[model samples]
Every structure is written in structure tokens, then in C-alpha cells.
Target: MNLSSKSVLVTGGAGFIGSSLVRELLREDAEVTVLDNFSAGDPSHLAGLDGSLEVVEGDIRDSSLTSLLERKEVDCVFNLAAEPYIPYCYDRPAQFFEVNANGTLNLLLACKEAGVERILHYSSSEVYGSAKHVPMDEEHPTLPLSTYAVSKLAADRLCFTMYHEQEVPVIILRQFNCYGPRETYPYIIPELISQLSKGPDLQLGNIKARRDFTYVEDAVRGAIELMKCDRAVGEVVNLGSGIDYSVEELSHIIGELMGYDRVNIEIAKERLRPLDVERLQCDYSKARELCGYRPKTSIAEGIERTIDWFRENNERWIWEVKIAPSERIWRKDDGC
Candidate 1:
């Protein structure tokens, strides 16, 4: 599965981690085609790449993804498409299942149909509800606490069974908390950053919750390396920072770096999830042994980079604050 000059199809390739993977693919001179519905991904995020980068605007559930895969002469597929926002997944569980679970089936069938050489299917670390043990590894029990996590875990198993029964070469990476430019989800880091950037008070819920945050670049790097590793097929591996940071701790760090010492932290009742997973910390040693994965950026460095991105590109994520608050708190609820 040598990626150099190989034809590759990356579904949801315009997304935060996906876009970063797209850049890596282009740098490696792989013929790349990006498929995204723009439901949670912004096309504008992929503003610059050209000459070996092809963009397809479509959904994974539709026949369009299969059709594109058939026509693209692709050697490998990277399945990164999902309805991943936690709060939104709770709001629309059916839609989340439709996209994350069923959509994965569509892509797996397409890959099998196309006889693709390799497929890297990404699952969320949220699939592991909380740390039953510190430094949770590949063998951790999956006790998904949210609809979004359930959908991803479903898809994760789907990929595995399809590999065994259907003989599709699928690799699953249960990615931990990933953050960077163009991250669509309103996770505590991004949401809190948005709130603190625009105003003095940072309104958040479940501040005690903790997670292992991985920078987007490191996550993408690991994914690409896994694509080239033969042992990665039919394997479920975790990709994370291996260190947990509480939301409370992150608020002060982000505030300090952004030079807002006076930023007030207030609990926003509406922002809390129905059943929150309390904590997550990754043990990516299997990934290290298999694909030489070593997450280089520390949390401090990653937060600095993320804050810099938000400061530079306020307009893109500012919509998050406006739309989210208005929908949940400020706007009057009137059934249509």
C-alpha cells in the first residue's frame, strides 16, 4: 500500500483531519480525490490544494459515493465521513446513525465492490465512554455513552466484521480528541475558545470532564503511516495524546495563552450532554509498534497552535457562537 503516486479516495476529505490528510497525500504525490457532503465540513477549508487534488461534493449514503469510487480508479480509501458533533448527535440520533453507521456500510460495500487495496476507517475515542483504567488501550471495553459514540462504535465493528466475513482490508483508528483549524465540532476546547475569544466569560458545561487531545497534524500523520503498514489491516488502534486534561484546566491554559487573564468561566446548563462520558486517556503503544506513531505536539503547544488559528480565522468559527447560543438558549422555541 505504497501511497506515493497511488490513486486515493478520501471521503470527508475536506474536514479538519481529512483536509490535513489531503494535504499530506498531495505532499506525498498521491493522486487524491476528496468526497464530502459539507454537512459538517466546509469546502472553503480546502482553498489551496491543486494539481492532483480532486473534490467531489456528495454524501456517503447516496449512490454518488459508490459511483465516484467506481469511476475514480482509486487504489485505497480513507473513510473519515461521519455525523460527529456530540450535542447535534443527541438532537438527531436517527440522522447520526444514518450517516455514521449506515453510511459506513455504504462505503465498505463500495470499497469491496471496487476491490480497493486498503481502507482506513476512523472511529471516535468517545466509543470508550470513560477511562476504566488510565491510558486506555486497544483492548479497552467500549461503553459508548452517547448516540454519536454508539454510531461510531457500530461503524467500527462493521468495518471489522466486513474485513473478516466480506474480506475487505479495513483498518480502524479510534481517534481521541482532535483539534486544529477548521474543526467543525463544538467540543469544549473549540466552543470554549470561541466563547472566550468573543467575550470575557467562558460558558461551558461538565467542566470536570477530561480528554486526551491530539493535534490534527499528528493524527493525520499516524493515519497515513497506518495506510502503508500491512499489519494495520483488520486492527483497531487508538490515536491520542496519552495525557488527559480537564476542561477546567484547559480553560485557564487557553485563557492564559490568549492573554485574557480576566476571562470568567461560567457553567452553561444547556450545553451539557444528556449522559456525559467523564474522562479519556489514550495508550497508543500498539500504533507506535505497528506504524511508528509518535504524537509530537504537547497539549500546551497544540492549544497554542489552535488559539493562533482561531485568532487568525475568527469569521469561520464565529458562526459557531452565533448559531449555537441562538438555537439553544436565546431563541424562543415554537413548534412548526
Candidate 2:
């Protein structure tokens, strides 16, 4: 679907990746309507987007979403609405199933009803679980390690089912760990940046585990590219750097970039994943070949950019400010 001059509906556009995509769409002069429940998303993330977009405060599961699609004359739907936190999903399994699975069902039905020509579904790499082989590809076996993973896998399959059975023009993009500015959650990079700003000493879990982290901009570009590719319908592609990094290494890099003298790292048992996937490396050959997609940011460059953003918005990291006085003092002295 040519996005130019088309009205696009981005569900959860106030969230991290969705907001990035929203900004991109607006840059192309495409009319955009953002539907968000504000459950895990913040309106502050949409601070710079003034009148260029319409904001619909609602849930994707609600039938109101269908009405919004119809009333707004939406040509395409980008479904980025889902509970992404793994531990949160484990604690609230019902919410996870409802939002991730049932919510997707609702959106697909709405797209069908609204006669939406195209749909892009944002899925996660967690659905692949621990890589049975290096550089996990789309054909890799999906043995979800967490409840959140299971929910995402179900949603992903639902997209494929809709394309095949219901004749919905849907494309699924399984993104790996995406990090950048305006990311609110205590994700790895944001969490480390927040902690490092408090002090050099940081406590974390499973430092040995590695993940394929994609810069948010690169992931957004991949999504846009996939949306433009007509052949991408009924296909699944992985969006990632195709490189993995350990948490310990990430901490040291972030600390150094933020000008910290020394980073004291300790393992926090309570913070560990119950069934941790030790490693993740994506095989992005399909994305490269199909959508002409390539990650432009390296881990070091991405971390540096993220650190700068966090430093500029230190007020948002208030929870990380509650550490020991000595740690706080250290952070203050180090210009964090």
C-alpha cells in the first residue's frame, strides 16, 4: 500500500516504537490517527506532535476501534498495541492473553470490516525464545520461554491466519530488543542509564544473557519499508541488528559513554528472568533482501544517543534517584 496521502491508524502510537512510527508517517504527509489506552503509554511521548495527528484515547479491544477505523477512513492499520513486559505478563496472565491475543483478534476483525487494504503487525523476537541455532531466522522453531512470549507468538500466528484464511493483507515484523529516546519502561538501556546516572554501581540480573538490540530508528525504518513493500503481505520478517551483546558489556559501555569513572556491577537475584533466553542474534537476510532494510546504528552509537537523551531528561528517571546517598553523591560528582 502506498502510504502517501493515505489515512493510517497506528494503535498504541503514544508508546515507544509506535510513536516513532507516527512521527515518520507524519513526515511523509500521511494523515494519521493514533489510538491508545494510556495503560502503559504516556501522552508526554507525543509532546512534539501537535495538530498533525489525531489522538483517540481508547483500547484496541473495544469495539470503538472499529468505529474509529470506519469514521476516520483509515486505509491501513498498524497494530503496535500489546503488553510487552515479560514479568508483567507473567504476573497478569489474563491481561496478557486478552490484550495480546484477543485484542489482535479485535483489530483484525475491524480491519476486515473497515475494508482496510493493508495491516502491519508488530511482533517480538521473544516468540522465538532461546535460539536453537545462531542467528535465529523466521523459520526457527518457536518455543516461547515466557508467558509474554507465548502471547506474542499467538498474536503473530493470528496475523498469518488472517492473511491466509480471512484474506487479510497483513505483514508481521518480529522485532528484537528496540531501544531509544522516549522509551518509558525500565528496559535494559533505559534502566542502566537511569541507574548509572544515580551512581556507577548498578545491580542487575543475568548479565551473561545476550540480546540482539535494534536502535529504535532502525526498527522504525524497517517497519516503514515493510509497509511499502507490496510483496511483504503474508510474510514475516525479523528487524534487528543481527548482533548480540551481554548485559555486563552494555553496562560498561553506557557508563563509559556517560563519563562514569568506574561501573560497579552486581547480580540481583530477584531481577532475573525465570526462564532466561541466554542468547539472541537475528538473521535479517530476509528483511534485507525483501525490504532493502539494513540497521544503520551500532550498539555503541545507539547507547551513546540513548545516554544523551536520558541525561537531557533526567527528571523522568526519578525512581532511579532513590538509591543510597553515597551512590547519589557519586553520580552527582560524575556529572550524571
List the global CA lDDT of all models.
Answer: 0.83, 0.85
Off by over 4 Å in 2: 317-336
Best model per TM-score? 2
User: Evaluated with lDDT, which candidate comes out highest?
Assistant: 2
- Predicted candidate 2 versus true structure: per-residue lDDT over 196-257, tens digit per residue: 87789999999999999999999998898899899999999998999999998898988898
TM-score of each: 0.92, 0.93
Tell me how candidate 2 scores on lDDT.
Answer: 0.85
Model 1: lowest-lDDT 10 consecutive positions: 327-336
lDDT of 2 at 326: 15
Cα misplacement distance, residue 214 of candidate 1 (Å): 0.6
Worst 10 residues of 2 by lDDT: 325-334
Candidate 1 stretches greater than 4 Å from native: 318-336
lDDT tens string, model 1, 66-132? 6687798889999999876787776678888998999999999988888789999999899999889
